[model samples]
Target chain A: MRDPGNSGHPDQSGHGQRGSIEALQEHVDALEHQSKTTKRAHQEAMRRERQLRTHNAVLAQLSMNALREGCDEHVARREIVTAAADALNVSRVGIWLFGDDGQTLRAVELFDRQGGFARCQTVIRADRYPRYFEALRENRTLPAHDVHRDSRTKELLHDYLEPCGITSMLDAPVRIGGKLVGVICHEHIGPQREWTLDEQTFAGSMGDFVSLSLQMGKRNEMEAAIKRQREYLRQIIDISPNLVFVLDEETRFVLANKALCDLVSVPHQELIGNSAMNLIKDQEQARRLRKMDEAILRQSQLSIDCEESFTDRDGKQRWFHLIKRPITSVDGSGKQVLGVASDVTERKLYQEHLASMVRELDHRVKNNLFAVMIMAEHTAMGSNDIDEYLHAFNGRMRSMAIGHEILAKTNWQGAMLVEVINSLIRPYVGENLRHVTLDGPDVMLPARVAPAMCMMIHELITNAMQHGALSLEEGRVDVLWKVEDQTLHMNWIEHGTQDVAQFPQRGFGMELIERTAAHQLRGDAQLSFEPPGLRCELNIPLKLPADRHE
Target chain B: MRMAINAQLKDKLKDLRVLVVEDEFLAAKSLETSLRKMGCEVVGPASTVDEALAFIKSRTIDAAILDINLSPGTSEPVARALRYRNCPFVFITGYSNISVLPDDLRGCLILTKPTDPVSLAAAVGQLAEHART
Candidate 1:
C-alpha cells in the first residue's frame, strides 16, 4: 500500500487514505500476531497436557508398584527415575537420598535416555554445595533455568553443571514421615531450558512416591522377619517332648504343638478353636481343669503345677506332671494359659515300690533285734565263763550277719538255699570250705524264715566243730537238701570221725538246734548218734501257711 | 518260820498251772523256768498258735504268758481262747507298740522282749491272783 505515487498525495483525502491504510495494515499485523500467539499458547498447553498424561500414567504405575507385595526400595527408585526422565522429556534423571549423617546426598538410581540405566554411586557433600543443599531443604521444588546464574544452583556450576553438560535442573525434595529424606533431580543436558509449573509438580509427586516405596520396603522386611520368627517358634514347639499348648481365655485351644496333638490323637489344625476341656473325657478331671483355667483367667493364679492321670488308648493309666502358666495373648484378645505336661507314670510307680521296700526293711530290723536279745541270754546261760559267753555270742551274731548279707543281695526278697548253706558252713570249715559239700535243688527261703534257719544251722555247726567230727584233722561236713511236698528236707552228716556217739552236749548248741527248728521255724529236727557221725534230718515248710504280713 | 512262810507262798501257787506260748525256744524255756520257780505247774512252751490253742483246749491252764508273734501265725488265737476260759494272760512281744495287739487284748499286760525273769514271774503271779478273784 505504500508506493512513490502515494507519498505525493499530501491532500486531505490522500492523508485520510494513508491513515486508513496504515490502520488497516496495523490491524492485519495485530491479527497475524494474535493468531501466532494463540498457536504458540496451544502448543504449550498440549505439551503440558502430554507431560501431565505421562506423569499420571507413571504415578499410577508407581503407586501400584508401591502397593505390590515385596516391592523393595531399589525397584521403586528405578521406576521413579525412569518415569521422571520420560515424563519431563529430560535426558538424565536420578534419585539421591541423604545419608544418615545428613551431610551427603548419594545417588540411588540414575537413568539416562541414551544409556537406558546406569549404576551411579555419585555423592554430593553438603559442605561442598551448602547453597544447593540449603535451597533443597528450604524449597519443595528447586527450579533453576540457568544453572550458572541461579543463586540456588551456582555452587554446582564449576563441577556438576559444567562437567555433566547440564544447563538447567528441576529438583523436588523427598520427605518421609514429615522429614526431608532426599531429592528427585531432573537434569536438562542441552541449552538452558525453563522448568514449567506442571513439571515441577510432577517432580514433587515422584519424591512422594519414593517416600511411599521406602515405607513399603521397610514394612515388607518387617513382615518377612515376623513370618520367619513364627515358623522358628513353631518348629521348637513341635519338637518338644512334653505336651505343649496355648489356650485362650475361653479355654479354647489357640495353639497346639505336635506333642499335644499326638497325645490327644488329633490333628494340630483341627485342635485350634476346640475347647481344651473336650480333649479330656473324664468329667471330674475336665471340671478340675476348667476351674484352674478360670482361676488363671481371673488372674488369681499366676501358674499351677499338678499331677494328673489319663487313661491312654491301651486302657493303661498314665500319670502326668502338668505345669500351666498365664501369658499375654499375642492376638490381644485376653490372657491365655501356656501348658506343658511331662509323663511321670514310671516315676510314681518307682516311688511306691521304694516305700514298700522300706516298710519290709523296718519289720526285718525289729525282728532281728529280738533274735539278738534271745541269743545273748541263751549264750550267757550256757557259759561258765565270760570269755566263753562272748565267743559264742560273737559267733552267733556273725552267723546272723552273714545270712543278712546274702539276703541283701536279693534286696531281702529271699535267700537261695545253696547260698544259705555255704554262708553258714564256710566259717567253721575255712580251709575245708570245699570239703563241706552242699547238694540241693535250688530253693529260695522266705524272708521271714531265713534268719531263724541261719541260727539253727549255726548251732549245729558249733556242736560239730567243738566236739564232733569237725574237731578232727580229716573232718568234713556234707550237707544235702531237696524240695518235696512244699517242704525243704535237708540232711546233715559228718564224716572222718569214728566217735559219733561221743558227741558232747556240754554246751546248749545241741538243744538250741532242736529248739529253734521246733519253735521259730515251725519245723522238726531229728538227730541220731548211731551211724555216719551224728546225722541230723530237718524238714521245713517251703511256703509258710497264712503268714502274709502285708 | 521262814521256811513255813515260803511253803505257804508256794502252796498258793503250787496248783496254779501256767501256759507259756513263745515263738523263740530260749525265751519260751526262760518263761517256763520262771513260772516253775514260783511253784506254778507249767502246761507248755508252745511255739505256735495251733500248739498253744491245742494246749488251752486240752490242758488245765489258770494263767498264761503269750508271745504275740509266732512264725506262721500270731499268739492272738491262744490269748483269745485263754481269755474265753477266764484264764488271765500277759503278752510278751518283740514289738514295742501295744497297738500290735488286737483291740480286745491291748488292755492286757504287755512285756516287750528282753524282759527280766523276775517281771515274768511277777506278771504270772499277778495274773493268777487276778484270775482267782
Candidate 2:
C-alpha cells in the first residue's frame, strides 16, 4: 500500500540542523514547514470525511427512493454517478456494470461534472488491460495519482488517460453476491490529484447503490420475457377450432374456449366450474369419459384418443373424438386435464352409409343373377340347336348388361325407362339416335325391373330390324306408352319391312315377352301381324315388384 | 280343369262390382282380368291417393283388393274408405312381413304376392259370399 503521509518525499537536506547558526535557523524553518504541512493534511482529511459522509447519505436516499417508487434503474444509476462526482470534485464519474457473462464492464451511467452530462455510454475490456484487471482484484481503489506513471493504470497512459488529460483515477470495485461485478470510476483531469482515503471509501459506497439498480433491471427483464411467453401460449390455445378445456381434479371445467362453451349450450360464465358429465345425457358415455380421464391422471400418461356420443341442443345425437392429456406444473401447483375434442358425427354417418351401400349392392347382384337364370331357361327351351341357343343367350346377356350399366351409374337407385330403351337401341341405332322413335311418358323404373324391360325391348327391335320396319333405311319404329289405371300399355309398331307369314315355331323372343308379361308384370300380351309390320302391345306394371325393397 | 272350375266360380261372382287399388299397372290389369273372369265389374285400379280418392267418391263398390305399398304413399286411406263404405278388402304384397300392414288392419286377410291362385280365389270367394249377405 502506498502511504499518503510519505508522498512528495520529505526534504533530505533538512536533516543538517546540528552545525551553524544559519543551519540552526533553517532547522527552525524546517520545523515550521513540517507543522504547516501536517495541519493542511489534517484539515484535508477532515474535509474529505465530511464529503464522504454527505455522499453516503445521498446514496442511501437514492436507493430508498428507487425501492419506494420503483423507478427506472438507469435513472437511479445516474443519480449515483452524479453524487460520486460531486463528492470527489472530479471532472467525471461513471458507474460501469459487468455484463451477464462478466468478461467486460459496460459504462451504464457517466456524469461529466463540468458539462453536467448524465450518461455517456462506454465499454471497457478486462482482457486488454491485464494489470488494471489484476489490480482491481487486489485493491479497494487504485488511488492512481499521475495515472501515466502508475503500474496498473500506465496501460491506459497513451490510449485513454493521457489523451483525455486525465491525470488521476480513484476506482473502487462494486461487488454483488460476493463477486466483483463492476466499479465506480472517478477521473480527475488538468492536474494530478492524489486520492485521499475518505474519497476512496466514498466511491465504494456509490458502487453499492449501482449494484442494487442492476439487480432490479435484471428482474424486470426476466418478468417481461415470461409474460410474453404466456401470452403467446394463450393465443395459440384460444384460436384452436377444437373444444379445448382444462379440467380440475373433480372433472369440473376450470377453463374453456368457444368450442367447449357451444358444446354445453351455455355461456362461458355458466360453463366454468360445471361438471361435463352433467351436460351429456348418455350415462354410458359419461362413465367412459370419466374412466378415460382417470387413465390419463393415474397412469401419468401423455394423452389418449377416444370417441363418445352426446345429445346436442338440437336434440340430435352428435359424435365427438377427444384427445386429452394431463398437464402438471413442476412446482406441483395442481394437476389439470387438457382436452381437445372434434366433431366426428359426419364421419360416423358416412361409415355406416358405406356399409349399407355394400349390402344393397349385394342384394342387387343376387336379384339380377336370378333373373339371368330364368332368362337362360326360357332361351334354352326355345333354341333348336346349340349355335342358336348360344346366339340367343349371348344377345339376351348383352341386353341385360347394357341395362345394368345404366342403373349402376345411378348407384343402383334406378334408371329412367327412356334411358334403358336408348341404351338397348344404341347398338342398332348406330350414329343417329333419331332412327328409332321413342315416345313415352317419363318413367323412373326400379333397378330390378330395368333388365327385364331391356330384354323385351331388345327382342322387338332385333326382330324389327331383321324382318320388320327398322330393317330398311327409310323405316322407323314408333314406341308409345302411358300410365293408365297403373297399367303401362306400351305399343311397339314396326313401320316398314318385308311381308311374310307368321313362323310355325314360336321363338324365344316371343316366349320371353309373353312369359315376362305374365309372371313379372302379371299383365296380358298381344302380338298382331299387320301388313306394314308386327305390332306387339303389352300392358305391364309401372311399379317395382312386391319383392323388391324400395 | 282349373279353368273350368274358375268359370264355375265366376258364376257365383256374377254381377258383383269390385274396386282394385294397385300401384303396379300390370299387376292391376292381371287382377282386373281375374275379377272380370269371375263376372265382377271392375271400378278402378288406382295408382295414387288422388286417383283412389276420386274413384271412391264416384263409385259404389261391393269389394276391393289393395296393394299395401303404393307409389306416393301406402294404401291406408283406401282401406279407410272401403271400411266406411262397409266394403270388405284384402291386402297383397310379396313381402312376407305382416308388420307392413297398419295396426288396425293386422287382422285383415293379406295375400303374399306370387300368391297361390287357390288362396286368392278362396279369399275373393269368401269376400263375395260375405258381400251377398
Candidate 3:
C-alpha cells in the first residue's frame, strides 16, 4: 500500500521503508541470538570433556598407587576400596570373597567414606545377598541403577547397603588363575547415577590388584609355617640323651649329636669325617665291625647285640650296646644307617664282681663245714661223754667263725698269717708263759689255702694247750713259716712239756692234723716228740688252682 | 709161663717209643711208671716249652701225650711240632670244655683225667695203630 502511489511517495516510502528496515533489524537480532547460543553450548561441552579427562587421570594415578603399595595384601585391598569410593563419590566400599564351596560370599575388607576401615563389624553373608553372590560366582559385573527396583536384589541390597545409606551400586569380580576369588563393590546413596564404561573398567583393574596381593600374602604364610617346623625338629635331635649318629653308605659319620661326642670323648668337629670303626679298642674287632657294616648295607636293616670295647680319648676301655638300623629316605631313593649306643661298662663289671663273690662264699662255707666235721670226729674219738663233745664242737665253731671274719675283711681272698696266729693263740697265753711267737714272710694265699692253714694252726694251738707246753706254767711255743721255690715250710716248736714220748698208735688229733696238712693242702707233714715239748713241721705247695689264682 | 709173659711184654715194647709232656712231678712220675708197666719206652718227661722243643728236635718219637695246659698257657708249640712230624698224639686235660683247645687240635683225641690205666693203654694203642696205618 505504501508503494502504491507516487504522490505520497516521500512520506509513504519513508514509512514503508522504516517498517521494512525494522523488520529486517528484528530478523537479524533473532539470527545473532541463535548463533551465540550455539557457540556457548559448544564451549560448555569442551569444559566438561576436560573435567572427565582429569577424573580419569586421577583414577589412573590412584590405581598405580594401590599397585605400588601391594607389599601387604590387607593394606592394598583397603587402599583400592578407598580410592574407588572417592572416585565414584560413594558412602562405603567393600571387597567380598566367594567361599570355596561356591554358596557364599564373605566380606574380606570394608572402607567408609571418611577413609577409616571397620574390620569385624562389616562382614556380609552371601545367603542374604543372592544376586551379588551369583554375579561374583559367575565372574560377571553387576550394575544396579536403582537397587530397590530389582526384586531379586532388593532385600539383599537393603540388608547389605541400607544400613550404610546406599541406594545405587557398582560391583566387579576379581579373578586370579582363572578362578573367581572375590569382588570389589562401590555403594552410592539418594539417587541412581549413570555408570560409565571407563569407571567400570577402572574398578575391574583395582579388583585385579587385590587378587594378586592376596595370593602373595597366602604364599608368604605357608613359607613361614615350614620354617617353624624345621626348627622344632632340629631342637629335638640336638638335645637327645643317647648317642645318636647317622652314617653314609661309605661308613663315614655324617651327623652326630652332643651325646655321641661326649661318649667318644671327642669334639663333634673331629668325629664327622672319620670311619665308625676307628672307635673300636682292638684291631681285630675293627675288622669284624667292618663286616657287620657291610652286612647292614646289603640288607636294609640289621640288629646285633655286639660286645664292643671302645677306647676313649684317654685310651680307657668302655663297653657299649650298639643298635643300628637302616633309614630309608622319604622318597625311598636314598639310604643311611642310624646308630644308637648305650654304655654298659658298669653293668658288666658288676656281674663279674657278683660271680666272684658267690664263688668265694661257696668255698668258705665248704671249709667251715669241713672244720666242723673234723671237730666232731676228733671230739668223739677223744672222749665218750656227750658233754665233752658238745663243748669241743662249740669251741671249734667259734675258731672257724674267727677265720671267716678275717676272710670277709679281705674280700675272701686270704687272711694275714700274723692275725690268724694272734687270734688262735690269745686264749692260751698266760702272764708267765706269754711267749707265743710268730715269724713268717708276708703271703697272700687263695681262699682254699687260707682255711686249710687256719685249721692246721688251730689244732697245733689246742694240742699245745691241752697236752704240750701250754699245759705248764712256764711253757712257750714258736710258730714260724717261710716260702722257698713255691713251697711253704711251717714249723711249730713247743717247750716245757712233761716228757718227750713216741706215739704208739695214731690218735684222732694226729690223724686230723696229718690228713688236713697233707691231703687237703697236697703237702707233707712230720711230727716228732722232743725232750721239752712236741715239734711239728709241714711243707705245702704255694701255687693254687689256676682258675682261683687270679 | 712167666718167661712167655715177659717175651710178650718185650714184643709190645720193641718199637713203642713215646714222649710225655707234663708239668706236675707227681703226675709225671705216675705216668712214667704206668707206661713202663705197659711195656712202652718213655723218651722224655719235658716240663716246659724249651725242654719239649729240644726233645722233639733230638729224638724220634712214635707217639706224644700232652697236657693241654703247660706253665704259661695251652701247649700250642708242642702240638704244632707233633702235627709237623705227622706224629699221632692225644691231649689230656683237667677241663671238660674244649673251647680253649687250639683250632687244629679240635675234634682230635681228648682224654679227661683222672684217667684209668686201661683207657690210657687203649687210647695209646689206638693212636699207635692209626699212626702205623
> Which candidate ranks first by DockQ, i.e. highest?
1
lDDT of 3 by residue, B4-32 (tens): 23454345445678888875433454466
lDDT of 3 by residue, A305-373 (tens): 566668777777778888877776435776767777778888888897887667545544543453355
TM-score of each: 0.68, 0.58, 0.51
Model 1 over residues A1-550: C-alpha lDDT tens digits? 6753345445766677877789889989999999999999999899878878877988888778755778777887787788788888898998888899988888888899999888776678889998898888888899999888999899888867788889899988888877888888899998889888888888888778877888888898899999999999999999997888889988999999898888778897799999988878899999999999988888899999999999876678989999999988996777999899998999999998887667555655665775687678778888889998998899999989988898789877788878877788777776557557788888999876787688778887877787666777777788889889888999999887686467666356777777778777778889877644878899888677777543
- In candidate 1, position B25 carries an lDDT of 72
lDDT of 1 by residue, B7-96 (tens): 544566777988888877767766665666677888888888778888888988888888887776788888888778888988887656
Record all residue pairs in model 2 with backbone atoms less than 3 Å apart, i.e. clashing: A469-A496, A486-B25, A487-B25, A541-B26
Question: What lDDT score is found at residue A157 in candidate 2?
Answer: 76
User: Which candidate, 1 or 2, has the higher DockQ?
Assistant: 1
Residue A189 C-alpha lDDT in model 3 = 73
TM-score of chain B of each: 0.86, 0.88, 0.86
Q: Rate the local accuracy (lDDT) of all candidates.
A: 0.81, 0.74, 0.70
Q: Identify the runs in model 3 with alpha carbons over 4 angstroms from their true place.
A: A1-108, A111-117, A143-550, B1-66, B70-72, B77-90, B103-109, B121-133
Candidate 1: misplaced stretches above 4 Å? A1-50, A227-245, A255-273, A302-325, A339-358, A373-394, A408-423, A432-435, A438-453, A466-468, A480-491, A496-530, A534-550, B1-133
Worst lDDT run of 10 residues, candidate 3 chain A, spans: A362-371
| Residue pairs in candidate 3 whose N, alpha carbon or C atoms collide under 3 angstroms | none
DockQ for every model comes to 0.34, 0.06, 0.11
Cα distance off (Å), candidate 2, residue A472: 7.7
